[model samples]
Target chain A: MIRTLPCSAAYTNGFRLYMVLFYIFLIMPLVTICILAFNDSNYIALPWNGFSLDWFFANTNERLGLFKDEGLMLSVWTSLETGFFVALFSTIIGTIAALLFEEEQFRMKGFLYFLALAPLVIPGVVLGISILLSSTYAGTYLEENLGMSFEFLGPSFWLVVIGQFSFGATYVMLLVGARLKKFDRVLEEAALSLRATRLEVIWLITIPFLRPAIIGAFIVAFLISFSNFNTTIFLVGSDPTLPVDLYSRIKFSSTPVLNAVSFMIVVFISFAAMISYVINRKKT
Target chain B: MKKNKSSTFFLLMVPVLLWLVLLIVIPHLDMFFRSFRFENDEGLMVFSLNNYLSFFEDKIYWLTFVKTALYSIGVTILAFIVTFPVAFFLTKVVAKKYSSFMVLLLLIPIWIGELVTIYGWMILLSDNGVINNFLMQIGLIDSPIVMLYTNFSMTIGLLYMSMLFMIIPMMSALESLDDSLIEAASDLGASKWTIFRQIIIPYTTPGIASGGIIVFMLVIGDYVAPNILGGKSSLWFTEQIYNKFLATFNWNEGAAFGFLLLLLSSGIIWLALKLTGQKLEKVGS
Candidate 1:
């Protein structure tokens, strides 16, 4: 019956308590690991094992030098490279796909739209395995027909990038399509009436209008690609992505070093989120 | 009026058609064809239901399917329990200024990737981890409780990852409701609980349904959470499928497993749509 606070101060107190509890449950794990990154103990236990920066600087096998470890660093860099490439490929292709969807005359528009989103709906693990199989088969076919062996095409970096795109592009299309759904045709008409070319109008008007959504789609696709474990798992070659590395380590024997990496990720991602939020706030 | 516009439409439609053909439709056809084509002793060749037959005959395959389905439902319910109050408080109860902070706080969990969240939980649940030491300090127990790798740990990880997915849709739905209805109910001398049951709950029914469906679909399709948090002891279907295709060199059986997953995922999507959706009926004035 309460539209307002119901003049109940105790109710507000209880509500605040409940909200605090939810926040605690939601955030405690994240905060704890982050805090413990500075703990001096090799173990992940509590009771405060004396605070130090060694977790960040520790060069041991199982502690904080995960940041310094060459193999792990290479994997991190590989994932970053893959993420950038995937985001670049997917966002451009996907934005074009969104533009295409706005065209009214496509006979199979309904079916095509569903098909574009199918990758997203499929499990990442399934998509990964399927791409690997299909790509390997195609690679073999090409090798026989052309008399050229394409090692990279079979199961490699560019393949991982393209494999991720087989679906990652769909997400970009969906996000951009959402904003484009409310697109006013009148603006394009007005630009045309002003003697603006289609390209000019697109660059000046449509691009500006779609900027926020485009940025959002790009960032999301990047995050998803970088953090992706399922699809990347099958396509992973000698050089693994960060998630693949983390998954392998987690599978065999996890050390506190993985915790250090997670701690760094928390810091970096939160900083990025905060910056985006501020920029968005200022824009509005 | 739109005669020449068809040309514009054609020009625009080319890219999406090409994308669908090259990426999605072709691979799906490949998957279907590969399902029937069992890898023989002679190498990759023609078609049969031998792969599918093997899928049904194996107890391990069937058991994994059951476990995955059960985990999906469990995570959905747990997410529902965890997300409702936070969303409800944000939309209906909290002060306007403070609710923004609360919403932003929820973003912290989501902003960190699911892998990070799982690892974070792992540290806390480790034998010598946070909880164990805290318990020992409080004189609660002598031995550290080994909590990770259990089904309970896996469920917690899934719930954490999926809670935001549930919250966002539900909040959107709840925010769309007219506040005046609750006010009207209050004016009629209704209690807060009664008003909630009669008005707010019914109004947001679609929201809850859609939110639950969204969570259910995502949870079922997920293999990551279980893999990272489930430890080696648990045998999840996607893990098995991954091993078959990548590690074991059995592409045919893997395709069969993939097809089965595709079937189950699609069926869940259909059921969700059926339950939460209704075609708009022409209402009489």
Candidate 2:
């Protein structure tokens, strides 16, 4: 519709130029990193000295590929573990919250809805720090008064999971809630009238209808937890997630192995995103 | 039946209540209280305003706070300026079939996460990075320009990671706009600039406001870009909080700084909302 709007030739040409440059600005850095991942140079930067697969497959005293890097591999495993738990918990809880919000008879609906969405507005760093402080306080109090050590409350794997879940669930709620809004309630009523129990109605009918959103929300939650840095950095203890590990390594000294890590992440996430995109398109 | 309904409601409410109270509400409230107290020399915690007072007494803390707030606002505005046209082009100019593909391209970088993108920028902006190498090869400059670990690189990094947030919302808003309105305005003898300023701007205010709020919050709270891409001179407020927590091990001071940051960023966002006449709930959704 807007393509037909009458405009000067200069205006059209200028807009085209801007669009081209904007995309370049957006995509160039990513492409640069992906290209430099195979560079045979010792440094992570440019002036590439011929191409090699050293970053990915080679392992020696000087150049260690991603496959053989123990610390990097452990962090990757830790991230995957954290992402899985965070995604699972957030999807279940967020789906329930979505259902609750959809209930017309729910009390304090507006205020409760606001509270549910509050995590989205809060800054990640603030959330991370506040959780850290409160959990430390709680841990100290428990150990002092009750002689019980709550290791989960401190900076540990579970702490990272909880911290990420704090906001991860909000995302799932929003995603699932949007889908729930478009649902046909008449189908639920029909199943209920046909003598199906409420539990069975939800399980057999509603869950199937919401399957796409639930899957999408789970993936989104996993990605959120996997890539999280600000919040996870505070809550991560001895073992760090991939992002935290990458951050420390990059901050101290960056090798192309880091580029190898980024290359793998880009490939994995892009594949996941494409699969989800295809699923969504097919459903719609 | 009534009992079943209430029980189901109760069941659903339990997790939501636990999550909000245990994770969101209580932690923030605890941090709020912790911000007001300090540990004295006797190894005892006491109620005092020293935590808050120290922020005022220390020039670097407040200065960094101000700088972070200002830079975030600047970046937010820059994001809007840089992405608004792209959003407009995608929604209005591009063929419908290709627009989603373009959006997918945009989402790819964002999904790749900030750390990777920052690493990408580091590769592009470093002294011997791609940009410098190209410039030197082209004989544009005799020596490599120190783009990394500076304010320029930091802003570019911040803008790169966050511009998508601005674009996504604006695209949604622009997608809903009727092309007939613009056509009518143009037919009514309105100049291109006038139509854009009067018609298009007013129509997309909500998107602009929401995107601005998000971009501002993200840029201000960002620690990675500033710490890595920014030089020693470019000290962000989040870094101050991180230093208090990890470096000095002052949870009290860190808590105080954390609250101040929350208050400062939220206050700015609130003010921006009020000025733009956008409600928190409306923009948040």
Candidate 3:
């Protein structure tokens, strides 16, 4: 559309310059961080001494590399573990939600749909704290009245998973629901008319058709759960997830190890993205 | 078959009902109720307006609240302005084959997460950081500029993290736009600015609204960028809520602040939707 616009040479040049600067602004900082991961300096930033792999490999007194940093490693593990469970739960629940919403005669569909998507609008901090507050209240009430302690209600591993999952499922629902909308109901009706059970039809036909979206939603939910901070911080206990751990460290003091971690994440995400992009292109 | 249909409906309903009731409904209602109660001298919980009242009475609280809203709105506008042209260029100016690749580049930062991006900005903006070091090497200045821990840096952090969201929606909107409309208008002697204002803007309003809402909500609720990048005086309202909950252990006040944040942000979004004549359902989708 812009190609059709009647514009002066100056206007075209100005737009080109603006785009150059915009891409620079977008890519420069990330490139800088990755470069600094190999910096020999003690600081996270530059004044580049010669390159060294100390951040990634060293385990000396002062230079503790990310590989050897037990605390950070544990946090990363916690995040992966949490991401797995959150993704699992959110995919199951959210797929069910997508299927439920697709039902033509469902009761109060509009209201229920809104309820499902409500987590998206609510701020993460608000969600985290509200869940934290209510769970604590429930925990205290139960302990006082029924003499049963619910450790999961308090800030703990499971609470963090639950907190992240609250919003994660919403995303999954939207993703899967979009794909579900394009599904041909005629195929299902044909299978049903031939005396196939509803369960068998859903399993053999519907699930297979929705496979791409289900896989995509699962990966997306995992990524969201892993990188989430605002909500996770409030619900995390002594065992902090990677983002929470990174937050406290960045706030108080930071080292080049952080750059190492960032560099690895960049590589991982870019690899995953390219693979998906290739797969998607092939599908088309 | 009738029993199977009912059972299937019930089977699906169980998980959705459990999730909505346990996670969404009860928690928020409990927080709302907690916000209204306070402990008296007898250490017993009683109803009071103290939490909400204190928000008005306290200068810093209400001031921070207003500042957060204004800054978030400013960032949203800035994000839109900065990304619109990029979106336009990608969708229209650039060749179709390469534009998708360009968009993939855009998605990398978003997938890399906020902490990594914030850390990247810190490396750029900090004293003795890359920019300053390069400047000093060229004999530009004697002293390093105090760019980090300032409102400028904080705003940059916020904008950098969120601008991609704006571009994506705008691109999708612009993608669906018919090119001949613009060509016809131009051929009919419509000025470029007039064509843009009359044709492009009206067509892309839905995308702009959705993107604006997202960026606004993100900036307003953001804790990492403000705390990590902003100076002491650049206290965001989320920080106030954080202090109330974790720092001071004042859950009631924190809950009140939380609700206020939710209400104010939602109210602003609602007004924007009203003014734009977009429905919540459509914008939300």
Candidate 4:
């Protein structure tokens, strides 16, 4: 919370020093990388040689190599696809969960809210391993007795999405729940009294009102899925997500190209975030 | 109108509630069940305390739990130190014009993935890395410092990864506070430190506790930062759980480890809620 005490100009100036150090510590490394993206040398560190675009443009074949690396590209696509589905599913589901819990007459509201939010508290790594163990156990049981072979029963892309879906949806629930606390039910009642069908009222009235929050929840879920490494690492199929792919590279043979990749990722994400922020701003 | 409304609401809720029960509630029960099954010639399914006991019986396994808790607390404190002042300046101290840009700068790190953040720290903290080379060139040290793959680096990694999580809630809370309260305190003759101690800290305690707890929870359960940055010495409980499921295929032991973390975090949260009664939800508005 803001300090509610009046301070002399000098004391305020003194506090400014800490803010400067915080910025320096947090921002300097990123600036270093941004600058090093233009490095002419093989290394991705300081003492820059002449400024050059060769590292950026001459890396076309390497980019193709990264694509030809089937596992990496596959995982990247899988992550993108998973992120989209998770975002879409979680936004719709979580919003509904939020609205359900927001109403006055729901019984065991606190406990239901707790259940909805518990996955967010649980760690991703633990969640991932738990999902894997349980799924494999079920898969084995089905194969032995039930006379069934199930692709979805093991650690595949589907299981990964399910694992992600469990907690990612919880995040969406909490976010939408928070926003729903202030939702005015009177508007719905007003629309309904005018003889609008329930479906018509929800479609023409409620969805538009909740649009910003639904979008916000989707963006958050998408970001979580895209960048998720801990859970995805264990549950990954023959392919891994982008984070997992990068992890293997860093562990094995790291080139400055990884830095190049990171730089490109920053560009892509920054543009997306800016667009989302602008939309969010306009909405508010 | 009411009858139709209830029906439509139920219709809207069907997929979400069904999904939650099938995926979350059931899987949680499965996690608890997996923790109890024992390993033997029969291959799984014997109720036992051996899984929990093994955490202590095997030094490496439970020790990681202790190490992870300590690491989480350490990183939480470090992040609070870095973020609180920045948030305070943004909310209370800085002029309105500059704070937005500074806040954006603070948020930029978040655009980078957590794994990428770890890599960024790894590059800076490597032996011939950015920070080491910079120090050496100024003749600060004759030899480049060995900074990689240590507990120190692990703390740094967690702090960097956790900063945004800590900052967002804290700033939001701080923004809601009335700036005039601080002016009143000063006008009534309280010193800056006195106002901070008596009013500011008390007002912000919820933010500190919530942000701190969230950071601790995320840090304690993290596997990537330790795996990449802690290289050798970073023994985290989540890693232990990872090994149990994947490496050794000991689901029971891993499940036990997961439950242990759950207990640890739950206990901390219980204490936090115990101390901060109605205080946290008040800060939201």
Per-residue accuracy of model 3 over A70-173 as CA lDDT, tens digit each = 99999999999999999999999999899988854565889988889888678889999999999999999999999999899999999999999998999898
Give per-residue CA lDDT, model 1, range A60-148, as digits (tens): 65554665677788998998999999988888878877877763544566677777777755777777777777778788889899887
Question: Per-residue alpha-carbon lDDT of model 1 for B176-271, expressed as tens digits?
Answer: 887887787788888878977888777876776667766776677667777766776666788778878768878888888888887887677667
For candidate 4, the per-residue lDDT at B78 reads: 85
Where is the poorest 10-residue window by lDDT in model 4 chain A?
A59-68
In angstroms, what RMSD does candidate 1 have relative to the true structure? 3.5
RMSD of each: 3.5, 1.7, 1.6, 3.0
Candidate closest to the true structure, highest lDDT: 3
Query: DockQ for each candidate?
Result: 0.45, 0.72, 0.72, 0.48
DockQ leaderboard ranking? 2, 3, 4, 1
* Candidate 3 off by > 4 Å: A4-7, B1-5
lDDT score at residue A11, model 2, on the 0-100 scale: 82
**Judged by DockQ relative to the true structure, which candidate is superior, 1 or 2?**
2
How far residue A249's Cα lies from its native spot in candidate 3, in Å, is 0.9
lDDT of 2 by residue, B1-285 (tens): 253464566787889889889999999999999988888999898999999999999899899988998899899999999999899999999888788778888898888999999989998998898999999999999999999999999999999988898888888889889998999988888887898899899999999999988888889999999988999999999999999988999988899999999998889988998999997766655
Candidate 3 displacement at residue A267 in angstroms: 1.3
Q: Residue A43's C-alpha lDDT in candidate 3?
A: 89
Model 4 chain B: worst 10 consecutive residues (lDDT sum): B276-285
- Model 3's CAPRI class is medium
